[model samples]
Target: MNISWQGVFPALTTKFTAEGTLDHAAFKHNLQAQLEAGVDGIILGGSLGEASTLTVVEKEELVERAVNLLEGKVPVVLNIAEGSTREAVRIAEHAAELGASGLMLLPPMRYKADDRETAEYFKTIARSTELPIMIYNNPIDYKIEVTLDMFEELLQFENIQAVKESTRDVSNVTRLRNRFGDRIKILCGVDTLAVEELVMGADGWVAGLVCAFPRETVAIYRLVKAGRLDEARTLFRWFLPLLELDLHPKLVQYIKLAEVHTGLGTEHVRAPRLPLVGAERERVEQIITDALAVRPQLPDYLAL
Candidate 1:
């Protein structure tokens, strides 16, 4: 299929009921909210979506729910990176069958991978489905790194169309842009460093924080894309503190709390993951309020 995944596509969070059941209504509301807020596309079952904590059936329900609510308003991509090649393949196949736009292949979590091994993993996932795949390269959370050489090899696969580069070293983004150019779209994964990476040369952003304030983020993106670097940097600097929260180890709790505080979405999450409270919750609350209190002005069209 013709592939072009770019712009602000937030990895939409999957909300749950207090009783621990999938809150389909909340999920639909957030998906609709994102599209309404001006995101170019939506990603389901990602780290922000708590996919790791979901069962197979739950994941299926989650993806299908997004598709139903989105109603083809924009593209939808799903994370199929749960450390199993076969299982990920199944998820990819289902995503395609259900009309998803693409797959975000995450490296095997719990351990790091050698360059050659990681290259093979990407190739395997690329071969599994016809849908274009975006390599989810988040070394911090997954503990797996896709080397530049590995990236070179992976991009050769016709189906591996793009990437979500989350490495802290934003310079790597410059390197990839210089090397690949228009061959593969480079999406900046970390919200905190998005402006820096874009300055270095990234086509789009796959951000969690954007779900909370997409209008602001999308405006920043458009400014950069439109050659207004100074304006983008000003917005980025102002929003830097909030973006840093996405890098926190307890990122999920913080994000959900931001959702709760802003009336952006619900903070209810599943077990094995507790709702933030006490000092942690208080800190996250402070972060949310601190960011929203000074919400910057962005362009109006990104909301369309």
Candidate 2:
């Protein structure tokens, strides 16, 4: 595919069977749904996919499957940034080998590095491959923050490319635009902040919970891109609560439950991460059901 990637790139769930093994068929089925929902691309193994917990091999399979299934339809952006630069490069190389259109990486977590150190980390990883790279700024969960100045410095790398802004500060997107203009592609990583981000000039959104309701997510983005904020805001109202779940610590579990409730994918998470429990599970179920009750179902091809 020779497409310039854009629009709602919904991070998909890696559906597993009851036996707990990766269900390739279920995953492909979900991919077809996102394609039908009008997304410009699919981001496999993102935060919402519990990607941090997945083994390198498992993530490889997920990206390979997505590329094989949707290669000609949409660009598949892969997120497989491990804690170290070496591991992150290995994953990025592996994904590029499997034909991923772009690489989405996170800051090296664990150690709090200064601006120069952080820039070195990103620059090293980008130098590892030729694929266009997009940085993921998700300070809330990763315990790491990328300052606007740090980002400005990182942009010096030609391959540093785009950014998935999840900082929750909408002005950051505008600030990025003011500094980089069209040089950098700004994607709204925080779903609730999507409308404002786009209104401020973001190119797209990498919605994690949107896997369960991609049609609504893409519809809002398309409307916004068309300068129809009046309609976009109305559609966003329907997705705000669902968007908040991505902010939850148990975002993966909540998103998986929402997918299951809507018959989009299975909710079987890996071990060490217990399946929901007590009031947590009950509360999640109620929220999932309530969200789905009002959501307009995505069309057949978008519904796996």
lDDT of 1 by residue, 1-304 (tens): 3447778889887888888888877777667777776777878888888887888888777767777777777888888866666777777878877778888888876557777777887788788888888898877777778877887888778888888998888898878878888788889999988888877778899988876776678878888888888888888888888888888777787788877776777878877888887987787788778777887766564533
Supply candidate 2's per-residue lDDT for 302.
28
Show pairs that collide, candidate 2.
none
Question: lDDT values of the candidates?
Answer: 0.80, 0.79
Misplaced by over 4 Å in model 2 are 1-5, 296-304
Please give the distance, in angstroms, between residue 158's alpha carbon in candidate 2 and its true position after superposition: 2.0
The digit string of per-residue lDDT tens for model 2 on 1-304 reads 4325468888877787878789887787777888877888888887777776777888888878888787568888888666688888887777778888888888886777666877788888888888888888877767677777887778888877788888888888888888878888888898778898888888988888778877788788888877777777877887788888888877888888888776688788876666898998998788778866787543232222
TM-score of each: 0.94, 0.92
Against the true structure, candidate 2 has what lDDT? 0.79
